[model samples]
Target: MAEPTGAAAPGFELPLLLFAGFRSIIDDLHRELAEQGHPEVRPAYGYALQAVGRDGATASEIGRRLGVSKQAAGKTVDRLERLGYVERADDPQDGRRKLVRLSPRGIDVLVRSAEGFDRLRAAWVRALGAERVAALESDLRTMASADAFRLDATSWFNG
Candidate 1:
């Protein structure tokens, strides 16, 4: 039997390690959020919350921004409404359409979440030092905006 053969394994580089570190940090953030009070919240919920921020939006518009079907967007809106994080009403401009917006309670939740995130960020800066943290953020942003780093191999955001 011939022994399996392959090129010598390349040692882990800084970029690979940084990517792994980022993945771990993201997972930890989600876990922390769940432990804090949003155990039922999912990624889709975050996207919807972001969409419905002060501007308010319709399910169709949310779907367009999130790359989901209108039905999926509506379902997410329903879930958020049930959680008391969002409200839906007839669009003033078009009574036939509905618009969704964050409720006062939802605004409170968002504020608290921002505070918690600030604490988390501060801890990271204290641990990594402001300069290193700044450098890491700059590198991440550069990569995030690069076409090769995008989901469709283009860019992360439209604007």
Candidate 2:
């Protein structure tokens, strides 16, 4: 029997496919964010921003969340501060440490990012239908919850 001309080979890996899909989504989201007056924030920066959160977080905490060294997290914070997306203030409880929080501009960026994600998801829903999208989301969440799939920003950020 001959192989089908256009079909994928049996050696295709699901992880590769998932990575490609994720990259595509990030690209689209980045483009959307740029279109909405929010640019210069890469996916890695987005992850760092998320680690900072709303209330605030210490550089050490962000480092732990991002799976990077404290110095690396400080560099990320430095870049974000230079970009006017984050501010560091003295920690009230500890005079020696500083708390990192998103600036007003950072909040705007996050809002725009959310809008971009919504737009991307909406497009996917249009193509795949809401039911399929929902199922896919559920499955992804389930897989993500597995202990084997640890969330490590350093792995994703290549740092």
**What lDDT score belongs to each candidate, Candidate 1 first?**
0.71, 0.85
Encode model 1's per-residue lDDT on 1-159: one tens digit a residue. 232368533455555666667566556666777776766765446656876768789998887766667897788789989988899988899999889989976786667567766776788899999999899888878866454432221112332
lDDT of 2 by residue, 72-143 (tens): 899989999999999999999999999999999899988888887898999999999999999998998888
Position 126, candidate 2: lDDT: 100
Q: Which candidate wins on TM-score?
A: 2
The true-versus-predicted C-alpha distance at residue 15 of model 2, in Å, is 1.2
User: Which parts of model 1 are misplaced by more than 4 Å?
Assistant: 1-37, 146-159
Clashes of each: 0, 0
Clashing pairs in 1: none
